[model samples]
Target: MNPPTPSKPSPPSSSSYSSPQTLLALINNILSIVLLSSLTIKSFTGRWQVIHSKLTSLGSSLSSLSSSPHWSENPLLQSLLPSLLSTLQRLSSLSDCCSISSFSGGKLLMQSDLDMASNSLSHSLHDLDLLLRSGVLHQSNAIVLSHPGPCSSKDELSFFIRDLFTRLQIGGIECKTKALESLLQLLSDDEKSASLVAKEGNVGYLIHLLDFNNYGQNSIREHATAALSVLASANDESRKCVFEEGGLGPLLRILETGSMVLKERASAAVEAITADPENAWAVSAYGGVAVLIEACRSGSLVTQTHAVGAIRNVANVEDIKNSLAEEGAVPVLIQVLGSGATSSAQEKAASCLAILASSGEYFRALIVQQRGLQRLMHSMQEVSNSDTLEPVLRAISSLSKLDPSARLLSSSTTFIIQLGEFVKHGNVVLQQISASLLASLSISDGNKRAIGGCMGSLVKLMESPKPVGLQESAAEALVSLLTVRSNRKELVRDEKSVMRLVQMLDPKNEAVYSKKFPVMVVAATVGGGSSHGCRKRLLAAGAHHHLQRLAEMKVAGAHKALQRLSGNRIINTILGRTWRE
Candidate 1:
């Protein structure tokens, strides 16, 4: 689609302000001229003479204002000047083509150049119309109509975007800028708009505008990059469009070379489009990781947030985790975690650490090397947001796998107590992570007593109907706590606790190994004759059948549990078996 070449009246106000009505009128005039030019170019008659005269007059007025002293001072007039000049240039081309056709007296315009200019003008005018009515402009207009999003409205929107893309292809900077703004507005959370824009081949337009290394205009580049991000963010198809159009290269360019604002915007887009693991790999291949790591190291909080988010997603690949740390992401992430970054930044930072930690002991040791555990634990105390806390807990859980780290964590009285409370009353995920941490920590002989003291909560967790993983974690912690004789004696004395342990052995639930281990641990404590009520509660809760079945399973823990139970005379009399048997 071609944009129209038509003269525009000079801005009425010397001041920077233009009322919404005047703005709308100016847009309408531009569209009207394009439409008229398209109709006039259909025939090579005197019609071109009338249109040329009107455009000539408009050109003179614009020239007069261009030399006026105050014209550059008014922002409104300043904006209008370029668009007016562009329109005049387009009109001048069309006028010359029309004169040739008229002199030859051809019934048809015969001049494809004139027809192409007129067609481009008509399309550009339509694009401007679409922008004006697109509801983005409505924010400035009081009596605005509602935005349309249904099927028909989307079709019309799709058509407008095609025209905008045409104008973009035709190389009018002013038209391209306006089209970028319109594209951004349409590409909201609306799926249809994104799909349409991608399907209509406008993704290339967005990528071209985002050519920050090539596009010298920072404002235009910023808008274009932002629009590209939005389009790519919508879904898989749109993201594929961006990647296929070679958007990743320019996005990385903006990240490395654009202004700070552009960097933040581009980083966010990188995060969105590279959401898929393969796409993330592509970004990493293109050396986006180093740029993002730099962003995390020195950029503003906003830039850090987006950069970290992108890193978090890209860190899905195991090799990338090492790459991130090798490039100095470990300390950067730890810094963001400790620096009191925004809740979102902290979440991403914590999550990135968690991903790295999940890769292996190397990353976990790295986190510990960076004082990551101390910082994470500290940040957990400062923030109450579940999202932030969840990742912190996950990283801590991963780190707890190392015996030295577990011992260190176990020694922190404050951290242990906080974790115990999380098991008791935190949300499901928090309960799960806390239980897992406590279970890991309980391996340290010194840590068992501290966890045993929180036996009441562990018992409650065993009885609660939570997700199977959480139940397993809680059960494991409970079993570890029972390894201490004092904890077993206290727990066995509580009939409810004994009954819960027996019920936990039912094996009907998932994670049967978790259930079996806890049962074996509890059974080991019971067989020692520490509590008189154990046999009665175990029989009362129908543990006999589950235990009998476990005994026949040939599992070592289950066998050991059965051997231990054999030593109880009351239990031996009931089952008619002994330890040696």
Candidate 2:
């Protein structure tokens, strides 16, 4: 942020005297005083020079104090807040009492006295913030906003707010030069106040203020951008307001026009809009997908996080998913999961992978083999926080949707067992969701003994005294494991397990089965892969004849089961070796 640079003071005003000649005379007297001081300094070589030097140094300190931030922790400076508040006769006094007419012919009036305006405004905001820290935020806010000080009006009230922000932008811009610090303070304020200024519709104003060549400083521009992040999430009505007001395009333009911070803020705003699923498609339609992907792939960590967040919000809906998926986001997100190890980046990549994986079978394979599952599991160890933990959740959720990703028994078992541990660690959400993923993995692939090892736990969960949600999730999990073509006979062989499942399917039992089996033939084939003797048991038990009838009818389950069975040369040859009776 640029500090306000000093320049030579202007000549005395013409109104100094009743006429121009008097002003000229006063100016001449001042010039003579300066000339005498120079001559006297020349006369006294060392002593006079030292005294002159000290006075000059004091003047410089005073000047810096006038415009520079109060540093020193000086009690006097700290006392200014309450002192100014007591002195302010009214809020209207915050402006110098000037008016400017807008192009729309609206009049904007300033209410505070010119001299104390900036100082008073700063103190007011500072004191209010202090009050809130003391825990009277709600009551204090109501009182302050209600104080119709001469500066108050719904329309005119905005001027003080704008003034406070502008001075904040300029004041901090002039010092350590980071107005972002102050802006973020406002941002971290409760959602209520952040929404107030954001909903007030100054987004376009803030965007315009972000010009790269602006005098105050880039840091000030950065602060404005920070403020925009809060505004973008102010409310749905407000987000649309920002969008319709053309704030969306200009805000996004910052992705290319501003610094890394600005880019992240702009990307974040786009994400905030996508949070409302209704606007998710609109974001894609408005060409934000490329911007989001560009940000996701190459932008800073902030941009990547927000970009991935936007993708996650949109991926839940169908058409929106195609839009995000089309922009080559899948490969980019996969790359983020690879190259970036930040918590947020990992989280987003996990979720995006889940969304894409669930879209179809090919996508499922794409996510699993394209190195998604491995990285997702790895991320669980890299970062902390609820958000970082979420991608694993989504990975599990998508696993439910996709079927399976790992082909090797070792890899699949490791991931499944790790997930079960997370579920057992006591997050019901994780438990239910993990159960769903385990179900998908078990049913989707040939890893049954692993499922069998957990069969007791799963079966017990199936009969647990949990809430309906847990019950439903447990049942779905069991179905996921049981849905594969091969598990049926083993589940049946236990007789007790089969009877339990049969009872689950029976209306006579208090418990309900979804009644929809994924595909019994698929289950049978999956069952066949579970053990050495299981396939022989099913065939010897007349399962092959039963399956042949299903194939004639073109049942999906039978088709898959036959395909798995057909792959075995011994089985094919033995079946072919048979002579018709």
* TM-scores of the models, in the order given: 0.68, 0.51
Best by TM-score: 1
RMSD (Å) of each candidate, 1 decimal:
11.3, 17.3
Give one digit per residue, the lDDT tens place, for model 1 in 1-581. Answer: 54444564453442543443354345446535544554546445555555455454444443444344433332333344445435545654454455333355453554454555555444444443433333232222212122445555755565556555644554456656666666677776466677778887557667877764545677788888887877778788888888888898889878888888888888878888778777788766788888989988888878888888989998887667768878898998999987857789999999988988888888888989889989988987898998999999999888888888887888887788788778767888898888877776745555566656567667667656557676667777776666676777777677776666776677674434455655655565655545445555555556666776766865447766655555567765755543234
The local distance difference test score of each candidate is 0.68, 0.53
Q: Assess the local accuracy of residue 397 in candidate 2 as a C-alpha lDDT between 0 and 100.
A: 60
Cα lDDT tens digits, model 2, 468-497, are: 555556555655656554455455466444
- Give the Å error, residue 187, model 2: 5.0
Candidate 1 lDDT trough over 10 residues, lowest sum:
137-146
Give the residue spans of candidate 2 off by over 4 A.
1-159, 162-190, 198-201, 213-216, 234-240, 316-320, 365-369, 377-411, 419-423, 433-453, 463-581
